[model samples]
Target chain A: MPQIGGAPSGDGLQAVAMAIRILEYLAEQRGGIGVTALARALGTTKSRVHRHLRTLVETGYIVQSPESEKYRVGSRLVTLGRTVAENFDLSALAREEMRALRDTLGQSVVISRVEVTGAVVLATLPGREAIEIAVKPGSILPPHCTAQGKLGLAHAEPAVRERVLLSRLDMRTPHTITSPTVLREELARILERGWAVAPSESLLGVNALAAPIFEGGGGMVGAIAILGSIQFIEAEPSALQIRHLRQAAARISAQLGDVGRDGVDSLPR
Target chain B: MPQIGGAPSGDGLQAVAMAIRILEYLAEQRGGIGVTALARALGTTKSRVHRHLRTLVETGYIVQSPESEKYRVGSRLVTLGRTVAENFDLSALAREEMRALRDTLGQSVVISRVEVTGAVVLATLPGREAIEIAVKPGSILPPHCTAQGKLGLAHAEPAVRERVLLSRLDMRTPHTITSPTVLREELARILERGWAVAPSESLLGVNALAAPIFEGGGGMVGAIAILGSIQFIEAEPSALQIRHLRQAAARISAQLGDVGRDGVDSLPR
Candidate 1:
């Protein structure tokens, strides 16, 4: 028999587990979902699901639509979710991987979320080198000049590319690609190569090599990059650097539910 | 006196409640928080708190720091939070207020989140008028022109304001504000007056009046705006219109935990 209410079959926190599953399912759904539907989907009795739904509604984790009388994720849950996303989660997920990347390459690692205006820095790990690129968690990297930005552009939807290209590409440095045609060509190559690089583009003496991180179902969620002085990293990045970067990205992607075959073993030599 | 489990007390979902409290507390905290500390904070025994933490970590809602062994929110929680924010919560919170505003004014009402690039439209209620404003969800309002954008700029941090002003402000219409000095002056006025208006700025013959929506700590979370033909929503809106819009914003803000004295009752006549 299935365990219920600390029945000693297992940890007996099955009620909490059920409640979380209901929430996760609700988050995935579009509109109001009724108790019967939720019960059927979760493979539980209607009464058990109903009790949990009532508790959730009381706690403001979910709300009942006034008109439909069906349930949906509520404001309090959304607020908690926002707090986790804003303060902890993404950077937390990348911390170990970032540390590993930095240790392997002796280069500063930067993680960025692909936002509308630019690739916004989410986290950064300092390198072993004395002279390091000074990028923080909130820095916005220009699309035409940074490795992460270019990778984001390469994987972004067509409309996103159109919007970025339509805007005036500000020249951050002498080597920055301000022309739409040049940037477009670079983005195309980056897409094909599965990685990106920007040498002396955003900063005169800084270079970065990046690869795309994917969420489940193959959507590009963000970019992971290694930052260093041009003395070590060049416009043409070393194969070792590219491979390690891609591998790191792939591992993070796997943890994020992207279990596709295009992982480390599938990389082209 | 404190309820624990399904004893002769209210609701009897104390275990679930305690689990949620732990998650919420962890979300509010930075870095890892220990079990002893959490137990102390919750006024519960160490063993009881530990059980819930184990279940939470196993479910991936939170994780134990490998080195510190303290707990924090995990990737799953973050992913769920992003899903809720991107798909439902803010719009859901504004729906009732938006509907009320539209019913009162017969003008289209738009809700927008202040993002890095611009004020992003989260939801819209079509006006009662036959010829309604055509703005929809996901539309990006240009910072120099739209009422929502102006209101967002007024409440934004100094760095955010500087970034928008430093960028080339493309004029959408002849009346669109392009000069940084002019926009800066307008923003100052908006901040002082507690609202914003843009007439024939983003689009000719189109106008919008907007008010900021504040969160718990009075941080401007987003904006609520009324959109219509310039003939209806004039550059100088009617007092009736302004009061209604501000009231709607206030009520929504109040629901979001901004229970300060500066609410509907405190508005200037």
Candidate 2:
């Protein structure tokens, strides 16, 4: 393997550095990026940028717009990202369970995983014959406010939780919890109860319930969440649905080889 | 911004070259790459590779798998890749219509676009119920056997189609049309009817119907495909569903600013 971003010692290392710089610049830009603008942003000559762009193009890591002479990242990168997601296998394992949950709860069901930096929605199965909520795969939501985010944070290691608490948390809605103390308390409660709920926190008029999915190593690898419009979610008479959600999560966790704490070690593969 | 592959005149270009070399090596592997293996593969020192890997990690373009200590592409790259996909926006415009088709036909629906080298599935909506046949987003199917592939080839330039015809087309299933003459005739029929079908051609017991999504500039940007198990699709004997699929494709193409027989002036804002 060639060095990715080390100091320019050789041609290979230099190429990798340039590619990283180019990707970083493109990531910062919300709209499409042009060659000249990218070159300017990196403080490099346009001709040089063009060559790197060509290499990125051939590799399907980046694409050039036919309408505008701009370059953007390509779908191949998404395929690669999905490979990281494959290890979790939450989608495949929970596909039927997610569908069953959505059918039973009549809400959007989402499976989310804790990544190195943030939480990402791995899969979403919308409710039957309902107003659809488009939760595309790869959509990232902040851990402090979302139900799955809270569940994941509640189950994360202390050091990881502390880091999250200290990091800047974006408030997507007015009801979003911004204070670290409040979030910490909420996470603790969620951990104790083995479930979490967020009512119009991340997005107005959307309520969500989530429970953690544990990996074989006793780590919370992901969460199964059910989301619905506040009107629908709140209209339920009792917390029975919440209980059901927890049961569903537990079943999924069991499927993932999480036998209760007492029997987990003795369970056969 | 930086030169990626070509020989650089200075240190900056040298860095770009190194990155490209590393990327090329990774591309060849088609699997997660280890630092030591990559170092040997690139004939570079491990420390140098480690440094470059660190830089790639910092940029969020590549991630080190905790399980294997091997490097794979990262989700950030997928975020950037999705930006490029958003730039295309053909799928975004067609999403609603695809949903409608899925509802109407009760089949998995796919929207695909042609790239310079191959065709890529831009978006896919699973059927109303759990179906065995589900084409994933970013799944690249062969251009010769799939219904969408045939639609794409039918509308492509004659010379391009000829080139494809000359190449060997792998038979994915026993029913796949591998004969060049048969494929050419099928392509002709597709061009004439503006639609194509594959009855258990790509996969056993799976069938697909596709129609080209063409722009006003006479460019066939993509296709709308409805796929299902042969049993269900054959049960509904109606050209109306096929027309609906074609009409949906046309609506999407129009949304891409296609005005039939006139050049694509501008996409719908």
Candidate 3:
């Protein structure tokens, strides 16, 4: 085992990065992906990607389909991901709250960690309906587009907010707020109201309402949101939806040892 | 991106392997691990492991505790693992079957992918009882010492069986069959009876009975098992338990296009 010194030959680190990227891309794809397509997506050559894929296949991180000769994520890797999520205190604690929210609202509930880039979904419970809005856990919701994302951005640190403002905000839908000034103003409104809503922004007909979850030190660590079709989770959310969403967020934050009041105490009983 | 030629410098591949191993190890540990402990576990120096840990932490694959300086799996990696598992058809398809088995037997039901080494759990459903036998998905069962593992071995290819026979069988408990000759006889019996049980073998007070699941072309792809306390899932299982387990396995196999019968067709109602 030679030392991986900080030299160009230290491409060992690069290989590790490339392997993870490949697994991420495969995880996102519902269908199997070929070496060529993966190489293109990764901005690397076919052979390089091929070698990495081969190693991943051999290690049981990704499995190559016998019929299609394409690769997909393997069960071993899935187990690894699940184990990580299961071990996290945030996800474990939030799930019971999320289930309760789902039961009361009959709509899908999501809990997301507020990251610099956006809100990363940690857990989700599906709505109790024939037609439900379901977001995959581990998917990122962009800062400019989603209710969770917007609430996360509004509560995020100044530097994090500046980063999102400086970066290009790709329009997910026609309703997505791309202007930094407008988003800044929207963030102010969310702060004042103690909740956030993104109607037909991230997707054409989907809408969500979010409230912030704080940790012990009064830091907004995450958000709890309810999502559905615009028809259900309207542009102006129903009184019951807002009430339960705020209560759920507050409950989770309290369990995490946060004593901060996000105006939940002021809400009409 | 330099082409990693097959020299010792190709430790790029080694780095990738090391990163994955670290993740797998972290996923297993409930508490955060220190750099020294991880290095010791990997049989490497602290510095080498530290560098890998830094890369992982930077990439959100692992996180280091600011208070304790110990490391644990991060949410991003959990999401990746879950995404991979959700993308797999086997886990999705078998979940419904596992739920049904749990309903019928009131014992925890597990579905595992049969590998040369053992059975790797893909999905599991908790039993209806207050004291349930719950096995985590993604954990591996040893071929010589568990019900699912034995059923997998009984139906595996000859080369695979030989490989297991040649490997050292560690004694998990007093009842675990460490002798290859004894295990060989047990495998033959499982083949004849079309089911397998490991009572007080893997764990002292637990037992499991398993039947094989097959994919197209009559190949054994996995197994479905009902596990509980030894009091419930006895060494000599009830006829109802055997019947339901076999039926569930057959139903899943049929869905996968496997038409072969392991005496399932001849079982009395």
Candidate 4:
């Protein structure tokens, strides 16, 4: 049987666990969600979730969206985020790995953070002959198209994954995943295979491969993507290329204190 | 009567409220704290605080330092922080205000975020002939010295304020606040005045004035600083300079949804 409360079944206080999960769910929604949808996703009753939401919102861990009439992650979390990122140097931790992937794979390597709104590039290292050398640090990518975006979606919590599937899969290119059925299938493939690749999905003639970076506790902190020409990166990367990319991703994740494992089965997924 | 459980006296769940306050206290520490210190700061029993800390640590909201055995803000907060920041664009929101302040004052303007460690430049805009245009965005300033740093400290929680004063005030320059007693006195004055000034505390002949930026909820999101030579910004800003600086700060705080009031009586102090 599932645990009584919504949080993971453990020795910890159920109320606290539920509160954190509520914050996590709000974050995944990016846009926010009403209490009904939130409770349904969390596998708890509406009243229980409402109690937790009240506490979360009161502490500024979550905010009620005026337009959507749903709870979204709030600015207090943003304040804590800056404190933790600067304290731990999560972006700086990803730097050496990005440079290595760029040099070894001969493709531009980018570290993009997975946020509530979308996958935004945190930093990028250009490779030899890389076209998109100037990828701005904060550019957002469509989840249905880019390798980094897919990597994030594939590892998202079930509620979030379902919601994203139920939402619009914007067609960035002909190859982008536009159907829920197709996208679900691709996400399962990403979980099983440990990497995602896109050939002209985000843009024509551009190809990329990405692997997830996990925090020590299991959540996917971000993803490292290797970008290059369609001819170079190809429809599916070579075995050697995949091996190098995975190594670079694992190294960066290690710096961030991830469990040193990239497989979804071993992570928060 | 005080709330039986933990947390501020309110109509909400005491456990949840206490848990959130514990995280806030950790953030103010900008590092970690032992259970006793945390309990003492929150005015809760050690056992009660420990129970909450266990829940927080288990959820990755807080982590224990292996060496000091103190509980500190964890990576999960970093995760939530990222979700809040990019989702809300607190830094981006401050960027627009920086330009206006610079344009109006004819002095270089800067937006600096206050974190556990110190005050950091979040964004900057140049004046008509500002030579310090290259003030790196992430530069950290001595907390006991800069106008931005004092603005942050003046509004920090009592526990955090005491801790910062307890530490050695590094001598960045002869005029730096090197004495705990004097710095404490200055912080009280800053809280009363709603601003701070540093004449060569960071570098010789460089003068600056700063005001705190607040969110709608009365939290200090960041601070705005106007920098120039002794002739331009002045050791003590003229009534006109103070007026423009305060207006620019209030406008940015409004953008961030601060309550539009900055008296210490209304803020954390």
Candidate with the greatest TM-score versus the true structure: 1
Which of candidates 2 and 4 is the stronger one according to lDDT? Answer: 4
Off by more than 4 A, model 1:
A1-12, A89-119, A122-207, A210-224, A228-231, A234-269, B1-12, B89-108, B113-119, B123-224, B228-269
**Candidate 3 residues A106-164, lDDT tens each?**
98888888766689998888889897679898899888889888888887768769888
Clashing pairs for model 1 are none
Candidate 4 lDDT over B44-155, as tens digits, reads 8999988887777667776554334666665678766665554554467677767877777788888888876678887788788736533678898667888988888888
lDDT of 4 at A79: 65
| Model 4 lDDT at residue A207 | 83
Cα lDDT, model 2, residue B163? 89
Q: Which ranges in model 4 have alpha carbons more than 4 Å from their true place? A: A1-22, A25-54, A63-75, A78-269, B1-9, B12-78, B82-88, B130-134, B262-269
lDDT of 4 by residue, A1-269 (tens): 22112334574777877887887767755455788998999899999987787676566665553334566665677766665555554467677767766777778888888865568888888788825543677799777788888888998878778888889778877877799998889989998889999889888888888888775467787888888788889987898788877877776665444545434332221
Please give each candidate's TM-score.
0.58, 0.41, 0.43, 0.50
Off by over 4 Å in 2: A1-15, A27-31, A42-45, A65-67, A87-149, A152-269, B1-33, B41-48, B62-75, B82-88, B91-195, B198-221, B224-269
The positional error of residue A136 in candidate 1, measured at the CA in angstroms, is: 7.3
Across B84-166, the per-residue lDDT of candidate 1 in tens digits comes to 65565567878999998999999999999876567999989899888878687888988889999989888877977988998
Provide backbone clash counts, one per model.
0, 21, 1, 7
- For residues B179-243, write the lDDT of model 2, one tens digit per residue: 98999998998887777888878888888888777643346768888888888665233577666
Candidate that would win on DockQ: 4
In terms of TM-score, which candidate is stronger, 1 or 2? Answer: 1
